[model samples]
Target: MKIAFPYMGTSHIAFKMLIRDLGHEPMVPPKLSKKTLTYGTQHSPEFACLPFKILLGSYLEAIEQGAELIITSGGSGPCRAGYYGVLHQKILQDLGYDTKIIVMESPYRNPFDFLGKIKSVISCSGVSWWTFIKVFYKAWEKLKLLDETEFLSHQIRPFECLRGETTKVFKECLNVIDESQTTEQIREARKLTQELLNNISQDHTRKVLKIGIIGEIYVVLEPFANHDLEVTLGEMGVLTHRSIYLSDWTRESTGYESKKNIIKAASPYINELFGGHGIYSVGHTVLYSQKGFDGVVQLAPFTCIPEIVAKTILAKVSNDFAIPVLTVFLDEQTGKAGLQTRLEAFVDLLGQKRAIQEGVVT
Candidate 1:
């Protein structure tokens, strides 16, 4: 079977490896573009969130390219994401595409169903259980490495002496990581990636602005969805730490990371986990403030309930903590120019605020 999955940061590279190792052809969707979003928005509900539209658009493209099966994650919360699988299936069926969909529900919700879904998908490939486990483990490790490399790039980009140098090395390292197959190959690639990034000329004395990115996972991770916010901020000499990454979310979903700890951080503002990552958004904002970040940015898909809730509370978090917070609502209609302008203004605000704090300017 030719399996396909939507893009979510660097996860597609890891998913491609896993599908191929399981003896299936991986039909990786092309990078998101305007046409992709168009197809998704045209077919999606008027009020659907940005991520759904983007994923649907990617799925349509993959199906057109003859993808036999599609895999996507599912949720069990009050968020509309819980119905994404069923809705997608309905939409695809209505569109006359018979491609099968496999929704990987969170193991934290139902361990048996999660395992059963994995077994069913791999069973079609006829790979032994041991081989499946090995392949999955390797893929997981690669995912962690990919996220780690990208994290390093975010930290180094703002400090690079030459404009675009960090981004250049980061793209090259992604290709290196993707080409790596064996465990030793992955290890070698990681070392090379670190050396290349660490070697980038940086001005340590530069007064860099620090920003924490918090919001829906999709926009936080997908450059296309968020109009490359991280890259934009980095080029402006801002150091950003995103609240969520593919690997971190995976660990939390698979029960390796404690949700209690994540929730504990948000308990002061939000005692319960609302649908989506509302709690996480709040908690990470608080954490960022505690860490002495200059400011925080929240990216929420329009009409996202959980984020709306978090946005409401974030205003209070900002006032009480004395940390600046900016929330940008994203939809198909969001434009790069406007977003850039808003970001520039926000950065200016943070810079002046920092100046006031340090007595650099009265």
Candidate 2:
């Protein structure tokens, strides 16, 4: 099968390589464009959420490019993400597209469900189990490594004045991995990527007020969806940490069980505060506050239930910890200028609050 993966932040880079290793042709949609958003918004139900619309556009484009299968993540929880595959499948079918939609559901509660979904896809493509396992393992490792690189890159993006250097390093690392099949080669690429990241200088004296951004994966990771908010915040001398990195999600799945044991030891209330889709997000915010981050900024697409739930709980956490929290809800009609105005206001408020707390603006 000629598989296509939608462009959703750094994840796409790993997915593209995964498809190739699986002996399938991988097609990546063009970088997020105005046309993409426009078409998505026009075709999708008005309140479906921003990420879904953008992905719809990406799938349509990939189908046009001869992709017979479209692969995306699936979820099982209170989060609307659980239904994206079905929704998109219906939309595409309604539009007369014959592409098969492959959803790799997260193996959170039901390992059997995850296995079943993968088996369905592999059976459809007639891929052998041995080959599938081999490629899947390699693909998982690549994704883990890519997520690590992206997390480090985000840590530096706020401090770097130029974007090209970090992006260039990421691309180089991907190229190195794509060309290499051995574990030794993958380890070497990791080392080189780490060294490149450490070499990037940080602005320690700039007083970049730290903000925690939490939200749905797509809106938080995609620059186009958020209007380059991370870059914009960095330009305004504010350090921002987004909570939706691939590594975080990966850990949430694989290591969450053990990690929960540790965090629970520290504070049971912390675990209880975030009940569902945002359990990790709320936990991370408390962690960040303890680390002295100035504030928390939560961004979610309008009608995102999990994030909304997260926001409500975070409000209590923020108040209890005295950490200011700002929540921004986004939708198709959200304008760039409006977003900038809100961001500027948010920064100003955080700055003033910080100054008063530190006696810098008496």
lDDT of each: 0.91, 0.75
Q: Which candidate tops TM-score?
A: 1
Tens digit of lDDT per residue, candidate 1, span 1-362?
99999899988889998999999999998778998999999999888999999999999999989899999998767899899988999999999999988899888788899889888888888888899889999999899999999999999999999999999999999999999988788889889999999999999899999999999888889999899899899999999999898888889888788767657778888888798999888888788888999999999999999999999999998998999899999999756898999999999999999999999999
Q: Model 2's lDDT to the true fold?
A: 0.75
Give per-model TM-scores.
Answer: 0.98, 0.85
What is the model-wide C-alpha lDDT for candidate 1? 0.91
Task: Report the C-alpha lDDT of model 2 over 204-309, residue by residue, as the tens digit.
Answer: 5566688877666778888788877776786677777876666566666755534563254325334443323466557767877888988887878888877777
Cα displacement (Å) at residue 122, model 2 = 3.8
Kindly give the stretch of ten consecutive residues in candidate 2 with the minimal lDDT sum: 268-277
Best by lDDT: 1
Clashing pairs in 2: none
